[model samples]
Target: MTDSPNSATAAVTLVSGPAGTGSIDDFELFYARRALGRFRARLGRQGLLDLLAADIDEGNAFLRESARASDGGYTGGTTVLSTQGLGAGEFVAWMDKAFADENVLLAAQPEHYLMVGQANGSVHVVENVGPHICSFYLGDWAAEAMAWADDADELLPKADFPYKKATNLFLADGTIVGRVLIQFGETDDGFTSSLTVYLPASCPQDVLDHHLRHFAVEFRNWITAAAAARA
Candidate 1:
């Protein structure tokens, strides 16, 4: 079960890198394919539940331990990413357990996106080619981004910052470990600029590396298309 109210968190992808995409469509494609691949690989082992509840643990690193559940001899684990003051090795070690839990990793298979490592407290392997599976949870994957975006939208609106075309939350892919949001605004010279933000290390290093590099290019391309559309 879920911990205290404050500890509640859902798995999501927030990809915020430097503003590079020259348009919007390009950014969408970048995140859709490359970033999605990266995120899938990152969760090669850990189930979605562990990633969503990552905020509950006090440790900055994610942990995976095979413990017995109250019901059947189900597997149980814990993690604490985005906590604070955790070493790199410790973080990676905890994340790697996802693999030990299963012999599979996302880096080895790029096409396998939108996976569910565990269902009904049991382990199962899946790939992106089948179905989005996201419909199974219905807005669950976007929880992190939605939570933060709601607050940001309110605060920004109050400040009258002219909230521009803000759309499409980023999933954990490549170097991005959390949800990413895309926002754009017009400058005094009538130039549109955008910014990307990363949630944290929600997944593995190798996986993040692959998604981020590709996403950055995608973001840039997206920005370009967005600007063109506005013109």
Candidate 2:
């Protein structure tokens, strides 16, 4: 991946959005990404999914209420990479085994989750590019969105990109507020990731600005956590 001059820090930019036509633009977004250094061993597809899925319990204060499964279990709420090569039943069995035997590096950090959900059911977001709280409900969409990323290579062939993850944002009341998409590219040392947050065109200017700062904070923390895990 090509590096941006500001990549070292938490720099966010408005890659795409609406032009204030008064009509709603569903695909407005701000984007940011960074390349964390390589590790002794890189996280495989399943490992990466495990780390992201752990966010509900491990994510910072920003994540609010997460959706629960029908069985009343914490779904962990992140999608797996494409199950392209394996059969459906085989993929299911593999996932079962993978979860049962968590990664060694990940298992070592029992207290720290890749990301954590708030116990108080409030979204704590960071403003001014620092850590704070913002309540966003992540449910089953987490899985579906990430699955889309896994299939992006085939779906958006013209884009010619691969290894991506995505998810929509919602409030506790179930109002769809925004969406996030992260693209991953391998590097000699490790990998680089680009993240984008899409909001509705009807959103206010201040809210959009705040989300830019929000992206800066959360992704920076996440990258740090990921680096630690790989180390």
Candidate with the greatest TM-score versus the true structure: 2
* Position 25, candidate 2: lDDT: 21
lDDT of 2 by residue, 10-99 (tens): 555556475654322222211111121122126553454454553433332233322221121111111212212223333223323333
- Candidate 1 residue-wise lDDT, 1-231, digit = tens: 631224656755546765764455556655676776656557643554465333323221221111111111211111111212333233233333443333234333443323344343322323321111111111222323455556453223413223322223212221111333433333343322233333233333433344344344433433333344335
Give the alpha-carbon lDDT of every model.
Answer: 0.33, 0.37
Model 2: C-alpha RMSD to truth? 16.7
Candidate 2: Cα lDDT at 93? 33
User: Per-candidate TM vs. native?
Assistant: 0.28, 0.37
Supply every candidate's count of residue pairs whose N, Cα or C atoms clash at under 3 angstroms.
Answer: 38, 14
**How many Å off is the CA of 122 in candidate 2?**
14
Segments of candidate 1 deviating more than 4 angstroms: 1-145, 150-161, 164-178, 192-194, 197-202, 227-231
